[model samples]
Target: MDDGTRLGQADHAAGPRPPGVIFTMRYPSDVGFVWKTIALHRDLIARAFGGEARCILAYPQLSPTSAYQPRWSTAIQADFYDYSAENRQRLERVITDEAIRLVVFMSAQPADVDLGFLRGLGLRTVTSENNSYDHSLRQPFMKRLAKALIRRVLKRQVFDLHIANSQAQYDFLRGFAQLPASRLRAVRNGVDTDHFQPGERTGACSTLGLDPDRLWIMAASQARPEKRLERVLEVIRAVKDARPALPIGFFFVGEGENLAEWRQIALGLPDAETYRFFGRQNDLRPYYQAASVFIHGAFRESFGLVIAEAMASGLPVVATHAHGPAEIIAEGETGRLVGRDDWEGLGKAVIEYLDDAELRRTHGLAGRARCVALFSITRQAQEFADLLRPFLKDGAGAPY
Candidate 1:
């Protein structure tokens, strides 16, 4: 082996490097959680399995060129709609020249790259999120008929094989999308445990000049309207009515379209200090550690990655039994999950857990345990490698 270039199979005790390319748009640089998670875990895979991935990136015409930085390494980049004949030839050259083994399409990017071209190359297509028929398809007969005709011939190459974060989503794809069940694999999102855990004694609520002893309940989000913050407020209001002097506080994290309206609603709630807004924190672990409970009231989420972080931080979850949490948490075992659209049930579960200090600790501890056993960065890389194995090196095994 070259002295400077360490051998893949025997480099270090961390683990063997898996062979082949891994792909994602989430480079380490992006401020968002999705980007960071992909960035950090790729580092982990590179350490253990000697893996490399190519990213297929495109920028919107509105964005500046400065926004396009390669996530892992300098591999691939193209304009979102710059697929002219000359450009297509350049991309074709990239596909052949670099020997890219597979492609992972992040739903966040504007889809380009002409599906026929990708399919013609025989590149394995992978999508990270689920896709449902556009709600616009249900609008009217003529429109629906047109979309139905388009859907028949416009097959998405990315859908043939996908890695989902939840079982419900996996089922949604297989049952509704007509994909084979064998092709759909489940890869649950994981939290960066080192960064998120309980007893972060920063006195976050206190630092903000809020009461230190309040039993704070936070519904953390960027504050979108469809999130059903009204449900969260209704439940919190009812809970506070009974325990008039309870030191319970509800916090909103980050800013979004509905911030003003939600703030107005928060003002009407008990003590008004009962509701607080903390705009996006670059470091969110302390918030998870600070709260006695973490609640999510989103109507739709692919997976509430924050709930995983909250669980990792040892705060019991009181999330809607919506798509993601329903798949991640075993209700009554890990955290309390209530029916979707039921603020009364959501609030009741949260109040019940808060009142029983022992149960809170027990459930929180169980959640943390589940997080460690089931969702780790290492396990995430391994599962991903399992999916990639069939494609790597002679197609006999995944290179690990």
Candidate 2:
């Protein structure tokens, strides 16, 4: 009620039936990798567990800065209640009333609910990937110290199970949190293979009003500092200069604080007209479909969801060998992994694919195969369900 959300409607609709799992997170808004994963999770859980599964999502509020409006999928049963300290009583009451068996704190961000609160309620608890510790190492000491405290709390008291999205993240959680191997699980993120699969380029290029003749290299991400948009711009510039005769175009799709800054940088480049920026697109499939290749230069990511999406779209990728991308891209097979901040290396990698159409086709097909086998939403959700299954019945997987 504090956030102007109604819990009564969801409760009334489900009647007295228990929701097998309750997922609590910081935000519920659209247009983030986390929310996208949650959408897939909800769909998969319902399919996997059927009537026996009633998953309820709880979040504090919508993303204030997001360009897209908040919209929830019809399939997910959600409550938009405020989880501030002041609204703790309401949160507790709703969890109790819904008969939640498992309480999953989606991130390590301070929640409206706390571990002690859940433990006091005798609820089985989980804390999923908070952030990339590998990425944090590059931050200022104060920021890194703050993350350390959060990691300590998560390791010592908060969760019965800690799920990391990558092996690098798992190592960080295991060592930093001092969590036992039994208490932690590494689960990679997934993409909707069907929706993201490859399509004919001509139609997509026409829909977006782009020339199909030029070789299109696309990057879709918010213009955040950690995303290294500056590095991406530099790579494209270097590649263009090195191969002046090559007809190439780069499209950037997404919005953020650094968009104008990046746009300005792109404009001053040699072939400024070739760079197109689409601010905050709802459907990224067209961008992916029309691209000859996808490139990402983020310094770090817990899981490279965009890279996976690009691969699912059957586009070969050139990404930094950061925490997430290093694991996702099968170097020399699906895509190439350049060192972080290595703009020249990244440029060369992109050029290699652009110069050879046969190599691009082979790698794109390989990337698609890899995504179908390892990163499908259905497979991801089923893995999540397996982790959650033992706890729903009894105290088997409950906290110690």
Candidate 3:
């Protein structure tokens, strides 16, 4: 890792003193919620600072077709996962060259990469703890224990501030991780309301080759076990079984380890032709716009960003009562929430919305309203800017 030139460098040297803030994350081929959230935040943080701060994306590597390809300001490619002294020296040079005053780990510092090294350089370090402990508990015992221990050590040792993406995540850090209240802050995820807002469904449906007459229910996320997409498939099966004549389709957008198996299972279900898996879509607006309802069946979600996007798209939601969804959906108002594993309840909720077009419209409008008011990208940017303000100021200091 050499002191490589920054990609898409902005002309910050000519204007008001703008503190450089680097957001570091793993830039893999598959675009997930974390990447999207960080990218959106980076752009918004730049705008919110009004020339008082410059935001940069620092990632190890990225796939050629990655949706997160940097479009503005500097994007530094470095070995963020490596903590060797040689790598640390290179990272330090990159930071010094960029004049970065603050560094935010998109999730936490990688297991091998220690934040203490960065903090020792007199740089403000913060960790946006995105994963939930409850979700980790679902993992195998040894893996769970290892993750818990690593996070505990990192949170207690080097990170200056810990930002939780949701109330649920905040609680987990407080109660489970046992971090002090002052060190933890809750900042819920936000969606780009302008991009995801309601639109005419016909064009999107036509482009996707979906029948305009059929009611489309969409789900988008990395297909993982905890996502419980199989449960959503069961709901779709039950609905199709009960109303054989009704034209309804289930369209999933995203690819993951379980996607192939899930797709196979979907093909085996009755009305298989109507269930489509569109893998790793670069643009999800079409799917959200084309659909009449959005369904999320994740067992535990720190924050369901897709749910907010769907709400912003004016689609009524039917999601499991996971901590994230429970906070986002106003029960029987914006959307319906069934128990995490309540297959029957999930089906019933979907059916109720499908059967009543007016009800769907009402909930959809309300959902969009809620998102615009609470979960807009601007609101999230403002919260983040406020948090980073102290660090950006001259002579500002951190607790660690």
The C-alpha stretches of model 1 lying farther than 4 A from their native spots are 1-22, 26-28, 51-98, 108-113, 120-122, 130-160, 207-209, 394-400
Candidate 2, 1-400: lDDT as tens digits: 3343334455456455744576664554555543555555655655676656567555555444432332321222234234467566666666676567887666663343466666777777876774755544444667656655655554444467778877888987666555657668988788888989899998999899999998999998767888888788888888888888989999998888999999999899877999999987666888899999999998877787889999999999999878888888999999999888788889999999999999999999999999999888888777777887777775554533
Once fitted onto the true fold, the runs of candidate 2 whose alpha carbons sit more than 4 angstroms away are 1-16, 32-34, 62-85, 109-113, 135-155, 394-400
The C-alpha lDDT values of all candidates are: 0.62, 0.75, 0.79
- List clashing residue pairs in candidate 3: none
Among all candidates shown, the one with the greatest lDDT: 3
Model 3 has an lDDT value of 0.79
Model 3, span 276-375: residue lDDT tens: 9888776788889899999999888888888998999999999988899898999999999998789899999999998999999999999999999988
Quote each prediction's TM-score: 0.75, 0.85, 0.89
Name the lDDT of candidate 2.
0.75
lDDT-best of 1 and 3? 3
What TM-score quantifies how close candidate 1 is to the native fold?
0.75
Worst 10 residues of 1 by lDDT: 1-10
Better of 2 and 3 by TM-score: 3
User: Which whole-number lDDT from 0 to 100 does residue 362 have in model 1?
Assistant: 90
